[model samples]
Target: MTLLTIFSQSGKYLLLSIFAFLLISCSESSPPALTTTADSIYFGGTIITLNDAQPSAEAVAIKDGKIIAVGRYADIEKSHKSAETRLIDLHGKTLIPGFIDGHSHFSEVGAQTVLANLLPPPDGSVKNIADLQKTMRDFIATSPIVKKHGVAIGMNYDDSQLAEHRHPTRHDLDAISTELPIMVSHQSGHFGALNSKALEKVGITADSIAPDGGVIRREADGKTPNGVLEENAFFGVVYKMFPAFTPDEIAAQLQASEKIYLANGFTTIQDGKTTKDNLKLLMAMSEAGTLKADVVSYPDIVTFGDDPLLQSPLMSRHYKNHLRMGGVKLTLDGSPQGKTGWFTVPYFKVPEGQPETYAGYPAFSDEKLNEWILLAYKNNWQVLGHCSGDAAVEQFINAVRNAQKIYPGTNHRPVIIHGHFIRADQVPAIKELGIFVSAFPLHTFNWGDWHRESVVGPERAENISPTGWFLTQDVPFSIHSDAPVIFPDSMKLIGTAVNRTTRSGYVLGAEHRLEPLAALKAMTLSAAYQHFEEATKGSIEVGKLADFVVLAENPLTKTRANLKQIRVLETIKEGKSVYRSTEDEK
Candidate 1:
């Protein structure tokens, strides 16, 4: 009963009192227990959430094709761990939100794969008109589908890179084959050349006048059509000229096309421009369960006009088979690189047969454009207009302004596509009018020199796709590769947007170059916003779609020179793997 006994008794009493207090406090209020388990846990990699709020995460948990949690591996695992959960080891790779191309013609990707490659250097090697003819001839000889269909089709023919320094006319295509109808599309997809047979098949004659908002280039005699068609004319004839594929063939073609997009890490792809017939085919493919990624299309005004399906309630925000019609598209002019985009100034050097005082012209009159725009506005349809030149952009601004007067107080999220020639002054008008731009920045790399020397002159060329201007003016914009014009490579898009470097090692618009992280956001969050799907997609947030792409290296860490070299290892959509590279296959 000395000091040792007294100390021991006092310590035991203190421990018992503290324990009793803790038990009483726990009994008063208990925290909720974790009840839901994740279906899969991905860790051991650099996970870029692309969500500015959280920014980055060490791990992600997914359940039912949605992100359940994103944070430190230990914390997320503690809450979502279960016996049935699948553990995904990233193997030291990098993960990002699945890319959403700002603008593209995804349906045409199938045709591009099956058709002859007529693109110039970097994508294909057609250096001149002679090379183009030979490429088509070789393709026709080897393709049983072309022979069976009795039509030879080729795509991505760029005049800017051709040795002849001119567009290949129908006369040029006729050299490839007069017996079978031959059609070669300009790389821009805004113009096309058809052989005599194709012209006759479409009923174009020396006396045939071009449709409004379209042009039928004629020979020196001013009577015989040269076989080159622009803008609306391209759609009118080519839409009917190509041999129709059966439902099974279309489904197969679409699946093959989606494989290419998936391989490039595009989870949400746009067809950009579609016809009612093409929409039907897409719908059929969607219903047949052949679609591998989300598709958002904007039908051309000509194709969307007066259609019962488009006018129905189902047309607004309607989704089927992972496909949705974002809105109506209007081609205000043609391609700037193709020399048909409307401009306020004359080209430094006009095309071979053109007038000396000519500037490019618009597809349709303002009155007609306004009518179509007002129709879309009144119907609450999102309008996506292609305006490659500043003049064309002005046309869009005026049309939208007038439409707003008729249908006031609505934020419809109207968009301007390929506003490559947008100037600093026009940026204010675009923002004031509450319009968004989806610009084609790839032109800087592929045709910067040509635009400077010939298309728009050095003054205007320096400002093409002026993204810096947009940022300064606080305007919303996104960058894109008008696919099939350029390969739909997301890495290339980000690289081009960040570096603004041409193939010949020249900086086109150094001021317009975006930061690597900002460029990535353009292809993800901004692209999703352009299609009005920002809340449900774009970022790796909780309750959002589990779409992601695994990269070999982190884009933010990769040097600008090595950006394009970064390969996509895998593409995931809805928590399901849609594409795996050869490296993964091994």
Candidate 2:
């Protein structure tokens, strides 16, 4: 053969090989063809999948409440389009996975809806002591709850935000009602104040001694009950004085709470630290098909460890009628802002009536904590421990470490809820132990100044929540609202996590602030993973639940300042519109 002829043959063979390679590459990159028509197709605007494989998508198709396809709008439309399919035009809105609750008392949020709003400035109008008293009085006169329940209840009153910077005493609540039994909860829900009538009704008196892990503030004489209760002391009065709700009343509260969560773009809600009665009520509500959004209750195992109800069929991973038992909740300590969180170092400023060297105290002995955690491990149950202070965090870590040694091969996925004050050094151990942290960065905006000035001082205040540390250590963490402690405002939660801005407009923990996308993941994918629902929920992946929120602005594209202002235009759950902004109707 001639040399020119041989060269020509080789060149032709190389060209054919290149063509074959290109064809295979294109085929591999192309989206798979859809086999069935979608029940609904969402397209236009931004779709953040939170799926690493496909970080963004042009369209999503859903059928029977499960995602069927996610890819380019053209591909999805061409393959999955049908006359009966619902085409949801985003109109330039941003779609994201519906938020899952990190940790919050869902039913208590329902109860808050009925109580007088005492949260400071943004969430409510009670900014000072006078405002608190006046609000309680107004609620007494106007609220049907007061008349029906025969008691006045107010929630979210922050001593830190009050004009006087002190807890409202029985004297202050008495100003609102001398005849009526009145109680006002500190914003942390770890402390409370009761009028003389309510205190007397609850059987607390000068002779009453505080519980092991709680305090009842006393008058100057050191013997008179001042009606300001803390931790266990406050909880005891709550159980005694709070009116019993009929099943119907409890259902109404749950309905109201679910609406608030839905309006805030949360699809999965956590009713953390649930009581036996409350759990039964929730189960009844589920059976009655009254729940619209998914609720996962972690009953107070400390109180009902022996209750046969803990072994119910409802304790599975699957939801039945929008409700399921996630696991158990254990409170290891109280709130930092309330000055009750267990800490190794002394608080910047001790609470009134406390010693100068006060560093707070634990909810129970370490032995008890270890015992409970080991029990959870033995049962292979996921346990969520509320540890807001470093000392409490240490106790939890030690307990978990011991439990793991005993029950070594199981994937219990024990969680540290509200590790708000965990030390930087502890992050490594947390990562090693696989302890998921559901932090409360919302505290930064709500009480960052208070923490700096009065709680833990400037240096330590900057580390509250410490999401940045978790990120640096490669520890899995999620952010939460701990609702009823504050409103479950998802935008505010995201904004605070991103900005770490105090109410005074100062960025308290600038270094600890998360990027917008990371903050969103803490509430979505990370949160779902925390709850072991990552496989079915969290992202807009095929076979996942069709749960999403439509935002007025894309968080990824917006300036940090504008993030909190982004509105939830619509919330969809299980391929259905659960909440639509009234503005959308316009």
Candidate 3:
């Protein structure tokens, strides 16, 4: 071979060798593109994210109890699928973010589960005073709680729904038991009836004067307490009558309450107006790792504002063992349905014993209210004020306004717990004060007729919750079922907000009704915002908690009147099932 031919051949071989080496190096340096795998992937049904940026998703991938990916099913499967991944097929059902409680007494609902069901039809069978007495009699005879506690108690009886349209008097309950101490709470939770024995046990007598913010309902003579107590009068005596439970019993009650919330699709629950004892009990439970769902407590400021525990690390936005002290609760007034909600104008018809000119009264003097609100502000604690009437709302607004003037530029996010009778004029101040309203639109379904006919008259009743006003004003708000007062049925809460229908089938306020999506937002996203947990919960977004609820039917597709018929099939929290209905198995 010639020298030129040898050199040319060698050069060709060297270039070829380098090209092969480059290929090998590139293959070794860059491993196959890594695909993120997830622990679980959910698909095959409608996914309502409650996130405006992505209103819907066909699938979601979860890892380490947080959403890792959300998009088309095919896209998620391509990137997140693995042999270890558990796939969840919704089977044409609906999946949405787990419901977050707006305003409800979680611990009290446990007590309600054990108490006699005096609620009217659909929840219980009590329809009249006689029915209430019979129910109490049955409870006294059959209930293990009564057997152990040695007292008969009934819960959630609405006088408005009774055939008699009047509160069950002590005389009525005396028929159930003059021997056994008996008490029945009004559905509103603002008033209560006691048997003569119960009255004697509580030491409330004809001479017992009503406290500053409560009423002791007098008989026709206007001197003798007729066995009925209102507001603080009921508050002052009711707890005294409750038999203290053993720690195990308390734990069981709390667990039972959590079960109800889980069954209803709630991942986050509230203990509004928690007392000191209950707060301590809950803290112990949280420390013991027994609490399953997240519980945010608003301890009653009037009682526990100065408690050392309130200053502890438990008072934080983060949960320790699924529990936290969110803030403090303040009661500005009573229930409007019970005629003690502190209104600026007289009710459409005065309650039986009240004078014609009587308007409801405040729970405390304005000075005390201002002091309490300012205390919360100075300490940078969020306040949840229970204000049902416009007058009470005004009081709250004024207090908040004054507090802001003193302690400006703190994102306290004060909340109005009920705001059932908030007037149109108050919307501006509510927005300006940055007060978020957790409204009770369930009242429209439960008591619209009573409100229209007796409480506030047709005109004012038309605006009971004022959801439409809030929406129009672009003010953020939330809807709630004041459970124990009514069952925390999420469907019923959403249906009421959308339809505004009364039990009698009357559309109390068509104009005030919300859209289905808006109502859902109120329950989920907006509610989380109210609790200052929007970033971690309330939506099915990447990096958020993997909390979701599966429903038998899509609430968005249901007719407005039928939204309440949608049933929860399963509730999943932190990528694990907490509740699954046996209806499918049956």
Candidate 4:
């Protein structure tokens, strides 16, 4: 690596949040001189540098937001130690590059965290209609949080697996609260379960049939929409019905989301999918310099047409060589568990108990989806499609092929997130087309049992979200937690990727297990590559940003069984200690 010559400040590094909560970054116009050098840098534990050239070290030096050196205690002590330096000895805790959450729904996840944590509707727990009625009564009976806003809003209910195995209709909701409107989003976010009042508010009725890649799931006998609005239908309702959130609420949600990531040692987060408005708030915060976490927000494809940022100052910023703007995101299909995702073949055989062989719904026509894909690629904004089913994955891959014909680049790494059910044959296209994949490794723990039984069935479940399989095929890949969807802990993610064991101890595709070293790369460097941020923050290398975490135990030296038990002790960003374990008992 080309090591740059830069001076660093010599003193104690303090976090902005510690005192009255002030913020300052390493750079602007001309970064303040780093000549006031700190001496004898140490973390009191193992530092597992992700840099392949020099894998482990005892200490790291930082100046001007860039790493000055990474090596052993004796060597660093001999050359860099001085009288005016501040040192942090972690008492033999593990250290590594700060983990990055490659994909997440920041706004939606934030909102969900604020709501009740009740199991989503269409859930197996709602054993019968009475159970569903009880839930509805409860959601309405409470004094509304935003009563002036005029709608009872709740989210993530999967009513499909219930004994009745159906969603609540307008009539059912009318029986409870006819005066106040009610709109509850399904677990998949593809559909909405509403009441008569809400339907009236949105002007949707049995006569209102879906126009595009949407469906109003209806009753077989009356043909009235059972209040299940899929794809376009759900987005349509939420976009209009729900009240806008205040800036403080937005910040609160973001802060709450960050706490979850910090405990997991993740200093960086890719807001996997967001709107231009959300992106604007982040930019305003960063420019005002209020943003704490390094965020990479990839706006949905719709923004490339109306408000393209290829030329904006925010799109091209480098915060202490930390945060960045990489590309655009596209929603291709609905959730597989919701039985709406497009599949080349019909979903697995559901017993008489389950309704239809439902996979999920797609958001666009094959032609329109393809056209949008080509447009995003041509515009120089790398595209990331949320395609999970085999057919949906095929659709995305086909779009990539189409885009390459007219416009092509070697580093263009358009990807498909949550490709949990793509076929084995498509593995070659990832390498041939230079596309990347940031898959959900945590799926092994959360839905491992469901995939084994209800979702994909047994035989094919072995092929689901196989990251290790991609490595064997020489396809570039990384692992992630779709954050509010799964806990955002890198160790937990690594465990899921390397262990493949479910809660019941049944290992899925044992041959697909990865080694600890390989899993680490997927969490760090490979993740940076997906976001086009490999040059700045992925690995702990000379001239790279000094962003890393201190752990309680060295992950590289431990076995897979102990990975999940590890905890993040401190998170350092740009030579400054941003987060430390306040709960650490002396």
- All models, RMSD in angstroms: 6.4, 5.3, 5.8, 11.5
lDDT of 2: 0.90
lDDT of 3 by residue, 1-586 (tens): 7655766777888878999999999999996888789999999999999999999999999998899999999999999999999999999899999999999999899888788899999888999888888888878889988889898888899988999999988889887767889888999899999989999999998889889899898888988889989999999998988877887887788899999999999999999999887888899999999887899999998887588888999999999999999999999999988888889999999987579988899998989999999989887789999999999999999999999999878769999988998899899989988999999999988899999999999999999998999999978899888888989998888988999988889998788899999999998999999999999999999999998999988888898889999999999988989999988623
Error of 1 at 56 (Å): 0.9
**Superposed model 3: Cα runs more than 4 Å off:** 1-35
Q: What C-alpha lDDT do the candidate models reach, one value each?
A: 0.87, 0.90, 0.91, 0.71
lDDT of 3: 0.91
Question: Deviation in angstroms for 179 in model 1?
Answer: 1.5
Query: Comparing 1 and 3 by TM-score, which wins?
Result: 3
Model 2 residue runs over 4 Å out of place are: 1-34, 584-586
Per-residue lDDT over 1-586 for candidate 2, one digit per residue giving the tens place of the 0 to 100 score? 8656766877888878999999999999999864889999999989999998999999999999999999999999988989999999998889999999999999899888888899888788987899988898888889988888899998999888888889989998888878989998888889989999999899999999898889989999998988899998998778677777788887888889999999999999999989877888998888888887899999888788858787788887889999888889998899899889999999999986679989999999988888889878876678999998999999999999999888887767889999989998898889889999999998998889999999999999999999999998889888899998978999989998998888789898888999998999999999999999999999999999999999999999899987989999889999999999998424
For every model shown, the clashing-pair count is 1, 0, 0, 29
Query: Candidate 4: where is the Cα deviation over 4 Å?
Result: 1-36, 120-144, 159-176, 308-311, 317-324, 350-361
- Residue-wise C-alpha lDDT for candidate 4, range 26-51, written one tens digit per residue: 23445544333544376567888888
Question: Which of the two, 2 or 4, has more TM-score?
Answer: 2
Colliding residue pairs in candidate 1: 213-363
Which residue pairs does candidate 2 place in steric collision? none
- For each candidate in turn, the TM-score is 0.93, 0.93, 0.94, 0.86
